[model samples]
Target: MKVSTHTCPVCGFDQLKEAPRSKSGSASFEICPACGFQFGVSDDDDGLTYDEWREDWITRGMEWSSRGIKTPRGWKPEALLKSVLKKKK
Candidate 1:
């Protein structure tokens, strides 16, 4: 068994203590306690993991909902245009 330790990027504190291996040996990630930050380590260009992105998006959505915030009309239009372009590809 190999022990993996991750230090918080923000606070430089070693708070999270876990070793999580991804499916198909894709990547690994750890959480930080001092700043509640999470990061992923992978043998690829993108440093973020799927879990990190999902969690971040979910958290952002929850925060936005709590604040009664709505996505801007301009942003929605841009997204719709991008979606149409992607579908056409």
Candidate 2:
């Protein structure tokens, strides 16, 4: 049997890792260690582009924040770096 691998579109990295399966059994995501980009295992199933995905992810966080959920202070720097790099695109 042949094995398939997913590549990162942002940095052209071939070392993609599979994310844990969700309870819904929806399509799985492949994460790029180099650029921290994630997408569905199959392109056809992944309707959102990188930016779209990021926006949705951010919106989810915002929703949680609105509910008074607190985020860790240490994560702020990494989130800022990701945002800055995203704007460079």
TM-score of each: 0.25, 0.34
Give candidate 2 regions above 4 Å deviation: 1-29, 32-37, 40-44, 62-73, 81-89
Using alpha carbons, what is the TM-score of model 1?
A: 0.25
lDDT score, candidate 2? 0.44
Expressed as tens digits, the lDDT of each residue in 12-85 for candidate 1 is: 33323653344564434554433233445321445664345435544554221112334333333233324433
Clashes (backbone N, CA, C under 3 Å), per candidate, total 0, 0
Best prediction by TM-score:
2
Worst 10 residues of 2 by lDDT: 62-71
Clashing pairs in 2: none
